[model samples]
Target chain A: SQQGEEDPQALSIQEGENATMNCSYKTSINNLQWYRQNSGRGLVHLILIRSNEREKHSGRLRVTLDTSKKSSSLLITASRAADTASYFCATDRRNTGGFKTIFGAGTRLFVKA
Target chain B: DVKVTQSSRYLVKRTGEKVFLECVQDMDHENMFWYRQDPGLGLRLIYFSYDVKMKEKGDIPEGYSVSREKKERFSLILESASTNQTSMYLCASSFQTGVSTEAFFGQGTRLTVV
Candidate 1:
């Protein structure tokens, strides 16, 4: 079963606009990671934020994690047409012996030029 | 750079046929994972291996079996392919066991069972 859920199944934004996607998980996690998938391709690792950390940034991507709320958000600043793709948030949950990472349903973002 | 590669980009097989999906990684990662992606169901884990000759069942592993005979190669096997099994299969590798670690994924293979 999936441990996380992402809001806004799909989003459309004009170029240069900022896009935000949110994800919520069910259990305690050691960290949360965001991924991007292009059409018919595999997922690309975007950024990872540990539970102890609150915010992280990579290039134009920003990820914020609130362990207290059990939720995380991904923000893309100055979006471009090439940034259009599916975004997924994966949660690493502390289980019995080893941890398992569960992925959410994902949000599809379309950046119109 | 770490490179994860899948054997095929697309495949078509008849129902009841045995199918094999191969994945290879050059980064000498310790963990490998198999996931199937559908329209709205997102990506569901089928199997994973932490080391050579060791495998673990993921959330949806009933119809799939995995083999990790080598450190750099992982294979997913379907004993009898069914029409419902037609979906995109993705392979990924990671270097660490913790949740904070990042994973590298292959391009994925679209399989069609007819």
Candidate 2:
């Protein structure tokens, strides 16, 4: 079973607009990570936030984790046409041996130019 | 930079034929994983290894078997390839055993079983 489920299965916006995607998980996690994938390509690591941290940022990307709610959100500011891709949230729960990151269904974002 | 490389970008196999998908990481990371991605199912874990000669079953491991004879390499095997087994296979590598470990991925291999 998937440990996380991403919201807004799909989203579309014009370039320069902000894109926000949310993910909810079922179990307690030690940290959460966000990833981006271009069409038919490998996934690129975007950012990771520990359970103790509330927010993290990298370039135009911002991520927030709310352990109380077992949820997290990723925001991409000033979206570009090149930013079109699928975003996924992976959970690394405590007690898992190693590299046991469970991924969500993912949110497909389309940035129109 | 960490690099995870897959043996092929695409593959084609016949039903009932044994198939092998190979992955190698340059960083000597102790952890490696194999996942299959489908349309709505997202990415489902098939198998993973924490060290040389070690393997563990993931969420969906019924049709897959894995080998890790070398620390830098992991191999996923399909005992008998079936059409339903065709999908995008992904390989990843990570450094440690904690939640904060970041995984590096390969470009993926699209397999087609006929």
For all predictions in the order shown, the interface RMSD in Å is 1.7, 1.6
How would you encode candidate 1's per-residue C-alpha lDDT over A1-113 as one tens digit per residue? 88888988999999999999999998888889999999899999999998899999999999999988999999999999999999999987554425556789899999999
For each of the candidates, give the backbone clash count.
0, 0
TM-score of 2: 0.97
List per-prediction Cα lDDT, in the order shown: 0.91, 0.91
Error in Å for residue B16 of model 1? 0.4
Write candidate 2's Cα lDDT for A68-111 as tens digits. Answer: 99999999999999999999999974434565878998999999
**Which residue pairs collide in model 2, if any?**
none
Q: Residue A20 of candidate 2: its Cα lDDT?
A: 98
Candidate 1: list runs displaced more than 4 Å: A94-97, B97-99
**Taking the tens digit of each residue's C-alpha lDDT, what string does model 1 give over B1-114?**
999999999999999999999999999988888999998888888887878998878899988899999999999999999999999999998876655479899999999999
- The DockQ of predicted model 2 stands at 0.74
Error of 1 at A93 (Å): 3.2
Chain B TM-score for candidate 2:
0.96
